[model samples]
Target: MGGGGMGGGMGGGGMGGGGPPPDGLRLQYKAANTTADDIQIKPHFKIVNDTQDNVPLSDLTIRYWFTRDGGANFIYNCDFAPFNCIYTAGTFGAATGVKADMYVEISFMPDAGVLVTGDTTGEIQARLHTQNFTLVNQTSDYSFDPTKVDFEEWTKVTLYSKGVLVWGNEP
Candidate 1:
């Protein structure tokens, strides 16, 4: 049988026998206030893939919003890169599995104009508006099992600001 696993009755399992290996892909974000000022916040994110097969990841997106005193403001709306601006080590076939760490850092600059007005203060609430990661076979097959892919729920993180809150819960 050439030891090729293609169909039933073959000693080796079928090509799709074992199917894709279980993937333990995870996307994580870390937030920190680097400046002494409480308003400045930095968010860093990393993607870790722990699967035997090389998974093709594309169309990754993450949306974020910041809120103070019930008022929210959209902060980021773009694709997430693994390292610099969102990193992809390789291209097309050249790309290997995401075994190492890939990440990006974004800084949140609050509207100083609003803070100066002095409405409410001392606490800033942040939440992930939307995050989506799609995985597909190298052959561009959409019918691939969705369960094998990994998706994460919105994550929320809050930071303390020394300044007063200036905006109201209008928009």
Candidate 2:
């Protein structure tokens, strides 16, 4: 298993901080199917609503990146997700050589009130398809971890009610 870090903007002070996060909402994420031969990498995001305040989530935007760590050489192709979701490839482009990295952003919007209910959760399942996604060879100062391909740079969850902003994780 690999790990990623989260910065404040979504609620709590940081990962595993004490006290309830602001707006009683937090992002819980995980990545699976992270092997060298795995043509597809799955990254799942779950919206954990911890309070009774019924905040309606209308949209979710995730900005993330993949670091080669200088391990292997590969190409990243397309991205896939369920309905109401969109994927945008970042400007840094795909990881091609040593120390190369790729950036991607995804946006999702479930049915209104699906992600904003208190004491319940809403989830998004996404995948990234790649060609030769594994790090088989290494050159000087090159590092890549298959498990670290799903790091999230930032995320924005918009809570809305009647077209008004109830709360949000984005600035």
Candidate 3:
């Protein structure tokens, strides 16, 4: 009675995990403030749909990896987002990797809307700071880039589509 054929996996149901979805996506970065020793780590992002087909925003998630500096109650904020920041939520958790013991995971509500071809979810200004407003060093942060004063394609940050790495190289 135990054939063990069908499987539950990454994308779900009977399909096994291969990799992220075929839809090509790029994560753009622009640092609102590049001071690594400052009170906040600002990593501005924009998700570019580089494919021919429209992608649902509900299926996408962006992760900014960093350390909490041994501080608890870290705060995350979306200063601005064109896709309605209200539809976006940020959570922090421990992760397995170098340069980061914790990460800020950005997720969207079901009504986050679809991303059309060659379109972008513009200027998602994400901010992270300690609860006491103390300075947190971002110099070694996996996804923090001080050189990106202007928007450019940044691969340090990771993107997931339906729980798979769709873009960027995780540190």
Highest TM-score: which candidate? 3
Q: lDDT (CA) for every model shown?
A: 0.24, 0.39, 0.78
lDDT of 2 by residue, 15-115 (tens): 33323333555554555444544445455555566655443333333433454444343343334333334332212235344333543344323342344
lDDT of 3: 0.78
Error of 3 at 124 (Å): 0.7
Candidate RMSDs in Å, in order, are 22.4, 10.9, 6.7
Task: Estimate the lDDT of model 2.
Answer: 0.39
- Score candidate 3 by TM-score against the native: 0.86
Backbone Cα, N, C clashes tallied per candidate:
8, 5, 0
Pairs clashing in candidate 1? 81-86, 81-87, 82-86, 82-87, 82-103, 83-87, 120-165, 121-165
- Candidate 3 residue runs with Cα over 4 Å from true position: 1-20
Clashes of 1: 8
Clash pairs (backbone) in predicted model 3 = none
lDDT of 1: 0.24
